[model samples]
Target chain A: MRPKTLFDKIWETHIVHEEAGKPTLLYIDLHLVHEVTSPQAFEGLREAKRKIRRTDKTFATMDHNVPTIDRNNIKDPISAQQIETLEKNCKEFGIELFDLASPYQGIVHVIGPEQGLTKPGSTIVCGDSHTSTHGAFGALAFGIGTSEVEHVMSTQCLWQNKPKTFEVQVNGKRPKGVTAKDIILSIIGEIGTAGATGYVIEYTGETIRNLSMEQRMTICNMSIEGGARAGMISPDEITLNYLRDKPRIKTLNNLDSLMDDWIKLASDEGALFDETLKLDATKIAPQVSWGTSPGMVTGINNKVPNPKNFEDPVKRKSIEDALAYMGLQADTSIEDIKIDTVFIGSCTNGRIEDLIAASKIIKGNKVSSKVKAIVVPGSQVVKYQAEKLGIDKIFKDAGFEWRESGCSMCLAMNPDKLSPGERAASTSNRNFEGRQGKGGRTHLVSPTMAAAAAINGRFTDVRSFDVDLGEY
Target chain B: MEKFQTVISRPAPLDSSNVDTDQIIPKQFLKRIERTGFGQFLFFDWRFNDDGSINEKFILNEKRFEDSEILLSQENFGCGSSREHAPWALRDYGFKVIISTSFADILFNNCFKNCILPIVITEEKLDYLFKSTLEFEDYQVKVDLENLILSDNKNFTEKLDIDPYRRKCLLEGLDDIALTLIHEDKITLYEKASIE
Candidate 1:
């Protein structure tokens, strides 16, 4: 018998039919939708007069354009209209919706896992790229375009070619202060933005197995940044434990039998992969991106790389342009770079654990007078949990604005955006040009590092802060 | 979807790499439910100043490139965000074809669905195209999709590579939903069996 990779097993099972020359009709288990990308997709359904084929498998939420500060009223007319459109579409289609007023309202990725909608061996997709976040549950998840969204909404399936599998193995324990975010950023930096193109990356290693479910989600969330179609970590005790208390899982009658199947979903021994890369996790350090792309990252202790060091003219030019736009000097230490704002939330790092980590650092310290810091939880549940733990108070007492849950300052679809030329230490995923705001400079960092920057008013090593993590 | 057979039009060069979708169309303009009418908002941040005046320095705003239908850009064009709006905005803004050294996966796939041909050319060939666009006042190149060839009248031609499946769909003006509907019976069976 041929040994099969995990991706092959799950993908092959989902195939309705595949001919010699046609694209595979892959059945999708879950379809997550948000405000920004679903409007046109629903409109496509309306134009064609097609009803949603399987509303039971589809879920809608309003996140991207929702303001984190104000829950009752959205001041921006455009933002309000997009949310309203999503509500009308979901109601019309008879799909489940977690609107702004709903307790489950949060980032789509966050709500999916918390609700146990993302399950092992399931194939999930959303119009937003962070759909990869669900892959942490051992699902084959990836992002799709609006047209593909409409197709899935109408048919509960997609036309896709099987992507080759790439294995990324990280061995050894990650050094203290180095997180899943840093590890992913370092991997992206080593392999440039397009390195994993045309592949689905399966992350395997002792280090990966040891990570918490939230940490694994953080790693998979940025897989798209590395250009992979998706990233997956095989489900284990950690995954099952996280799902045990989830609402959906609690409704299951045969939990033990389901767990048995999930455990067997791992790739067989001697499974074939198209490519493999191994890294020593002990060597990874807290990373920061100095350029517009997530791949332009280096260890926090390192100096900004000079463009002249690049042999490729295209790379050299990109580095030069990024430096000019970011107001960065070549060979200068990253620690010396001052930031005007610090954002510590997004689908990438807005989980309860992430907020707890940031709150530990900010417990007794005040945010620097030179900086304006804000923390937005990933979901309303996370916000509620933080309040129960008094983490919100820790942040607010530290001079950081403890805002409501949403993708605030990540893409700046709302009022919480950086002014032109303002620099931010962000915990969100992408740092593309004008991603946070028009002409804003973003240096991607981890939650702890973002909190450190808030207190120091500059990019500082989290290890340098002599803080105790008591009862965090 | 329009059938894309051939296109011969003036090409404008955007000499930048990693041109993400956010830059192509800012998130603020993505509020509209309709896919059309995105032309005015294409590159809104770069093409216009904060005071609502045109920024003359941007290449698209230059008089010579105003009517160009083809865009020649560097590698990794449309790198961020899975917005179909990126391609829609480009097509709505009058771009019939995009030639780049490479394209981000989602954007590349979205182009075929919208009938906007995204051709992948080598960096060396891209340099030649960029040079030609700048050297000539009204540079025009002929893209023959049937033959998978890009040719300039003056001593330049390059063979492009595209998936035969995508090429056929583009040429036939077939959308994915329509094609998938052909297997609706099989899909229905699979869904019913899985539920049971």
Candidate 2:
């Protein structure tokens, strides 16, 4: 047999059918659905008179448009309607739902792996773009649009073109204060957003292997931001340990056999990738995105770049437009850029580990009066765990609003949003114009950096803070 | 989904690269259940001033490009978010053909699901289209889906590269779910063999 990449191994195993001039049909093991993107998909299924092929394989949750402060009283009528529609659709289709009242309810990407529904050597698809988050467990997970969502619901399979493989190797030990978010951000900055447009990236080498599963999820969560189909890390002991006792997998009796099969999902030693890029992890600094796109980022220690430094006319123009939209001037130090809000939550960094890292920087400190800071947990279970550990008190004592989980202020589909012209240092994925709200400016940073910014009311490097930031 | 045929109309050139879906249909407008009526909100932030009035300088606002069915843009046309609302808004806004140097993988796939035909041309060819749209007052291009050719009748002609499966679906206005149901038995067998 030809030495197969990890992606090829999983893809070939899942193939159900193929034709000469058509996309290959691959069976999907999990189909995660959320409110904002699934209503129309359900409507399509109803109109077609199609029953869900496998209700057991499907899971629904309400996250994108739910209010983090008050889940019971949803003031936004449209958001209320969307949530209601999902509840009705899930009931009609016999799909299990982790509704607002359910203890498992959270962002679809966050809850999938946290509950162990996301398994290695399987394929996962979600209507939301952050579905790549589940790839941390070596699953060939990727985001699909709503139409494809309907297809997966009806057939438990999807017609997909084979994606080429790209290996991104980050060797050497990461420096203190640098996180998986920083490493991924630096990689995006180096490779323009479209660098891996048609390929799936495998994050390899020493630095990736050394990170925890939660940290790996943060790295894979933003692969879509870099325009890749999906991003993954091969399974190892850390992966096995994380899934060992998860609620969904604990009931299954054949775990030791599963672990043996999961470990072999890693690519063979001599497997060849279509393309490869290497980054020195030791030299990376904590990163912050200063422009509309995630790729337009810089190290926290650096100043905003001038457009003239870029030779490409289009690149230069984009920088100029980003600076104008962000209400920033070239050559200004990043630490001097003031912020009005600090958002520390999303599928990207809303895990329990992220909150612990942020709280370590926030304990015994006061949030700046000029900034309104909020921390949203990724799942209800995460919120329970954080509160049990008293991490919630650490944040609340620092004047940060500790709220329920559900992508709060990330995309701002709910009432939690930035007013016009208000700037936020966010731990979310994209910094696109109006991603948080209309006329709102966003700067992407890690949770610790966002916590430090909350205390300083400006974009400050985490390493410069006097607090002892623990290991991520 | 609507069938794709030949479209002959003036091209609206949006000379921007990495024009994300958030910019195409901002997040505020995504709550609506039906895919229709998004045309009004297409490029809402860019087409209108903050005070709720139209910005006359935007390309789509120009009288010359009114009712344009072909949209010409630069590299990486739809880059962010897996929202199909981007293509729904574009098709609802009367764009049947979109030509760019490159496009994001997910958006490129979503375009096929809608009636929109996303075409990829060389950078040099795209520059010529952009220049023609900017210089000529009555510039029009005819996109022939059946023949896989694009021409402006005056300047140049170029071939289109599209997947045969995608092209067939667009030309026939076929529903993907109905087509995939043909392999229902194979899907059931695969499910039985796999362990969850």
- Give me the candidate number with maximum DockQ: 2
Model 2 alpha-carbon drift over 4 Å, by segment: A466-468
Tens-digit lDDT track of model 1 for A61-88: 9988888877788998988889899999
TM-score of chain B of 2: 0.97
Residues A1-472 of candidate 2: C-alpha lDDT, one tens digit per residue: 7887789889999999998999999999999999888888999888878889889999999999999998999998998999999999999999999999999999888999999999999999998778889999999999899999999999999999999999999999888899999999999998889998999999999999999999999999999887899999999999999999999898888888989999999988989999999999999999999999999999998999999899988889899999999999999999999999999999999999999999999988999999999999999999999999999999999999999999879899988898889999999999988889998999999999999999999988898867665558
- Per-prediction DockQ scores? 0.78, 0.86
Off by over 4 Å in 1: A468-472
lDDT string, candidate 2, B55-157, tens digits: 9989889988888999998888899889988989998999999999889999999999998999999998888888888788778899998998899967688
Q: After superposition, how far is residue A144 of candidate 2 from its true place, in Å?
A: 0.9
TM-score for each model? 0.98, 0.99
Cα lDDT of model 1 by residue, B1-196, tens digit:
7888798877888999889899999988888888889988998988999898999999999888998889999988888789999999999998989999888888988898898999888888899999988888757899988998989878888887778888899999987888888889999999889867
Model 2 TM-score, all chains together: 0.99
Candidate 2 interface RMSD, angstroms, 1 decimal: 0.8
Angstrom error of the Cα, residue A65, model 2: value is: 0.6
Docking class of 1: medium
